[model samples]
Target chain A: MELSLATRTVAEHTVLEVGGEVDVYTAPRLRERLVELVDAGARNVIVDLAGVEFLDSTGLGVLVGAMKRLRVANGTFGLVCSKEPLLKIFRITALDQVFPIYSSVEAATGDGTGSGPTS
Target chain B: MATVRLSFSPAPVHVRTARLVGVAVARRAGVAEELLDEVRLAIGEACTRAVALHNQYGLADLVTVEMSDSDSYAVRVIDHAPLEASVGLTKLPPDELADESLTDDALTTGVGFALLAGFVDDLVVRPVEDGSGTEVRMVWPVQRR
Candidate 1:
């Protein structure tokens, strides 16, 4: 229902903390934010979904679009998803293969990652 | 026969209405809690799609939602938005097998008709007769693993 976006820079990586339900109505806002950040030359991007209680296909679409955009620019896009229900959705869709998922924001921004390819 | 009807504007409230109705129906049908969550998500997706289409055409008025449970649970979404060329399931192109975008987790996963198709056992979309609006009916059989 509500969306709060916060951005922090860690070395050269840009961390985006998104807390809210990302559905059709709110997806456009997320897409716009990712585009702005990518265009501004923020390459390595980490999306923190720890606060996201719900996500749908539209939200997934925006994230996918951003991942492609970032990859095309030879950048990296990672995710921080902790919730089980949300994580199940990602795994069912095999998105666990696309986005490198970390257990926590610290781990995602930390040394070792899980499932997805290392950058 | 367990049934419930709700009417709300084609706005954000529609999503909540769909979710509530879906979970309620699933519970009444004695469906498992995890499966009930899937039904709720599928119904929410369908209602969201309908609302988005209606809003795009400036038809932000009352939309009727009918939830019924018989041998199967069904949710019928009715909206007065002008049916456009792009609104039906048939309008969607064949699944793009080679489109990596479609397979991408961030792109293809989660709430959509695709998820509904994957979750619900039976999904049907058709135009409502009498030249009124679109009707989307989705059914989940009572017995499933």
Candidate 2:
């Protein structure tokens, strides 16, 4: 399936909503969008993955690369992922430890409880 | 035993098709519901790896996938890239392999293989018998009903 990416401002953060399958085929677009956001000076970026159906290592690699880039820019990067299957991928790769993950955009943006980095 | 075989051009777009077909076969083969996601992810990883190898090596040959349910639900993804494309991937631990092959700024080329190791409990990678490319073999237990 094709990947869909949309960005919006949330408080001071940019929330990028991602949907559909993220395999080798469509991950480049995600990467390019993320790079565009960073280049445009988005410091605190949150990716909302509530609509994502499938994710593979290539997708994970792109997320990691974005996080590292933001870190180098002294910015923050987080992910919003509640799906068990996607969560399982993070857990297995130990990426759950690397990226700040939340149940919702509000959590990541600290608008709500900022309740996660969900285990 | 029920078996299904598919062959597609070595391209990234075809990887998704392979994953869908694999999960469908796994579901029909009685693979547990909880494991269906793993099956799909594993299949995607394998097919993606094959596609990447083919792209890197400029191979236009087809990537082949076979799914069979007998002793277990098994999936094999084969790529026609040279055997050297897969060297040391099966031998090293995922992290160490990634570290070893890593460039200055890029993640290792074997990162997908590492993810495959994480997704599949029973996995094997070896050169094809005819000494052409590599075959990634992964198996999961089926719920016998």
* Best by the lDDT measure: 2
What DockQ, on C-alphas, does every prediction get?
0.30, 0.41
Cα lDDT tens digits for candidate 1, A33-100: 99999999998999989888678777877887888788799998888887887787665555666678
Model 2, A67: alpha-carbon shift in Å?
Answer: 1.4
The local distance difference test score of each candidate is: 0.72, 0.83
TM-score of each: 0.75, 0.89
Q: Report model 1's chain A TM-score.
A: 0.90
Over 4 Å off in model 1, which ranges?
Answer: A82-84, A91-98, A103-107, A110-119, B81-111, B141-145
User: B1-145, model 1: which lDDT tens digit per residue?
Assistant: 8688887778764576567766886788767666876777777777777777677678867777788877777788777767673244421233331145554332332336556676667777677775757777887667544
- Winning model by DockQ: 2
Q: For model 1, state the Cα shift of residue B131 in Å.
A: 2.3
Q: Quality of candidate 1's docking, in CAPRI categories? A: acceptable
**lDDT string, candidate 2, A10-52, tens digits:** 8999999999988888999999999999999999999999999
